[model samples]
Target: MPDLAAVADLEARLGRPLTPDEQARAGALLADASALVRDFTRQEITPVTGDTLVLRPVGVLLRLPQRPVTAVTSVSAVGPTGSVLGALSGWSWDGRDKVDLSCVSPAGSWPLSWTGPLPDTYQVIYDHGRATVPPGIVAVVCAMVLRTLLSPSMTAGMVAERIGAYNYQLQQGTGAAGASVVMTSADEKALARYGPRRFGTIALEAG
Candidate 1:
């Protein structure tokens, strides 16, 4: 995975050229910040292809874990021995993160007919995620990296607190380097859309 913000992005924000040491440190922090954003979002931040998943769908719909699915290449039924039994054709992609196996049947919610043991699992290969990282996400990640880069060390007591924002600034000093990086409540709210969707709600993606 690539970092959301590049070293050049950090340099642009600072409005000055980074020293060699600063560049190296900023690169490390940017990588850490990008990973943190992914952890917060709980989804892939960049486009991915040939992604595969195995599932046993319970209802007419099967929700994909990744978002903004561009294509579903294949959906196959798996036998007990994990061999590809056959290709399933009666399904549709919802254009975001769901696969719909249309109609219900006597065998189960999925429309399948068999006297032999019905397939209990399926394998789906698809392409998903954004063509470009969203600007908001990039900005947030850069901010996080900048915060950590500027204040690499912290003292014991809180320097300042913002009640409404629900954030506190730690005092920085020559005490220690590489203080733990964290996200604020505002950061969480900014990234909420990229996380897992709640039931009954649909996320629409632009084609």
Candidate 2:
């Protein structure tokens, strides 16, 4: 799941079979690019079911976690004494922090010591994560992988060198133009165009 781009896709972009080392390194770098995608979106790719998400009540409103939430199984309030109020009834999930209640429950009105930084007033069990990734995002990831495979000297510049992040630069070129200094490789230019440049505001907030 860490690999954001398929090996076949990278091979297609590379236009050749990867060596054993290149395959391994590409896998690792793909993982890094994936992590960047996750971070850029501020969303988790793999969210487990039956996990609880805590929402701090801000007046009558509460903020939910990253969206496309599948279900809300239960709700509770944290008491001032740190004990949890039992599950409540008559609450409907309306999406994106919009919840309808037949009546106010004990937990909903529960106040923390300081409202500036609030303790979670509400807790719920919900399943949530991105349902789809944009094709352009996937293309960017594949481009990054292709760039890494095309440049061995630039391995140190890949995100996987630090457990999942982009180094923000293309690999140096090795193709010589006679005795003149070699220019950037076409592969590197493609990567620079498709890599981080793809993470626009829309892509950043993409689910």
Candidate 2 residue lDDT tens string, 1-207: 445567777777778888897777766777776766655554554544665655555454444555556667776665555565556666677764355443545445344343443334666677665456545556767765565555424434432223256453333333222211122344244344222222111211111
What TM-score do all the candidates reach, one by one?
Answer: 0.74, 0.59
State the C-alpha lDDT per candidate: 0.70, 0.53
Name the lDDT value of residue 171 in candidate 2: 34
Show model 1 residue runs off by greater than 4 Å. Answer: 80-83, 103-114, 152-177, 200-207
Worst 10 residues of 1 by lDDT: 103-112
lDDT of 2: 0.53
> lDDT winner among the candidates?
1
- The C-alpha RMSD in Å for every predicted model, in order, reads 8.1, 10.8
Residue-pair clashes per candidate: 0, 0
Where is model 2 more than 4 Å wrong at Cα?
Answer: 101-120, 155-207
Candidate 2, position 121, lDDT:
60
lDDT of 1: 0.70
